[model samples]
Target: MHSRHMSIVIPDTTADAVYAFAADPDNLPQWAAGLASGVRRVGDTLVVDSPMGEVTVRFEPTNRYGILDHDVTLPDGTVVANPLRVLAHPEGAEVIFTVRQRDMTDEQFEADCAAVERDLAALAAAVTV
Candidate 1:
């Protein structure tokens, strides 16, 4: 299993507000650019137009706590678990995403981490804007 974790601090946002936005799979493409270019709902599932191909995404049920876990199913049927969270912080709120190395090389994993950082920054800018 891939083992890496990353987080970002979004100023002037509450955990509840962040969770409300991030927990929704429809908002993913707006923030997680590496995941998909766009997302649309089809009945109970979300279809994403990803660079890898069309993928399916399923998010966990909403809860009071800021747990935004989801699963992404690739065209080849590989399911990747994405564990995300928004937690209350002294300044504002912190969004955390688990970054798994998967089968990528070190350089690839570094690039993936960079992508996650960019995504988180986009999320920060989006919510703040």
Candidate 2:
């Protein structure tokens, strides 16, 4: 169960602001490339059009602690929990995403890491104070 923590600091943005923006499912497609195709709400469920097919995404309830954790249910019924956070930083806000190497090859894990980096970059660009 190896994991890699990747982060990006959003300059001039408060942790609260970043959390508020990123925590919303509506903003996922704008920043999260994996969900770039978009997401739809079907009776309280968030269904994302992913490369792997239609997956369900359930996020943690909104909180002041900056937790943006979510569970992604794949088409095959496998649930993958992704832990993410927006922390207060001197520069502004720092967003961290943990990439777990669950049942993945080294190459797959590396690609996942790179994808997370791009997502964080997109998040940094999308979040504004």
Candidate 3:
């Protein structure tokens, strides 16, 4: 599988603030528009209504390390791992998202990457506001 790292620096924002917002599944729909439409707690998992279908998202336990890694289970029972991080930057905080090309064509991968870019931009806007 091939992977691409997409990132954006939110000027004047703290890593803690960025992490706090990004770590919450409920806030995903606000920034990650391409990934989630709505989210609700379902026992131990976060049930998400996505464009693909209803999926389950499992995030790593909250920590001070700025790790927002998560596993997304598709409706077909396929699990896709997403690695995300918020790091302290000179200006503010940098958010990085890893997009993987598991079994997609080059065009599909490019589209996926573009979507991630847009999402990261949205994240920066939301966190900085």
lDDT (C-alpha, whole model) for all candidates = 0.85, 0.91, 0.90
Best candidate, TM-score: 3
Model 3 earns a TM-score of 0.96
Better of 2 and 3 by lDDT: 2
* Residue 100 error, candidate 1, Å: 0.9
Better candidate number, 1 or 3, judged by TM-score: 3
Off by over 4 Å in 2: none
TM-score of each: 0.91, 0.95, 0.96
- Stretches off by above 4 angstroms in model 3 are none
Question: CA shift at 129, candidate 3, in angstroms?
Answer: 1.4
Question: Cα-based RMSD of the predictions, in order?
Answer: 1.5, 1.3, 0.9
For model 2, the local distance difference test gives 0.91
- For residues 1-129, write the lDDT of model 2, one tens digit per residue: 799999999989799999988987889997999877758887666999998999998888888899989999999999999999999999999999999999999999999999999999999988862
State the displacement of the C-alpha of residue 59, model 2, in Å, after optimal TM-score superposition: 0.3
Best-to-worst ranking by lDDT:
2, 3, 1
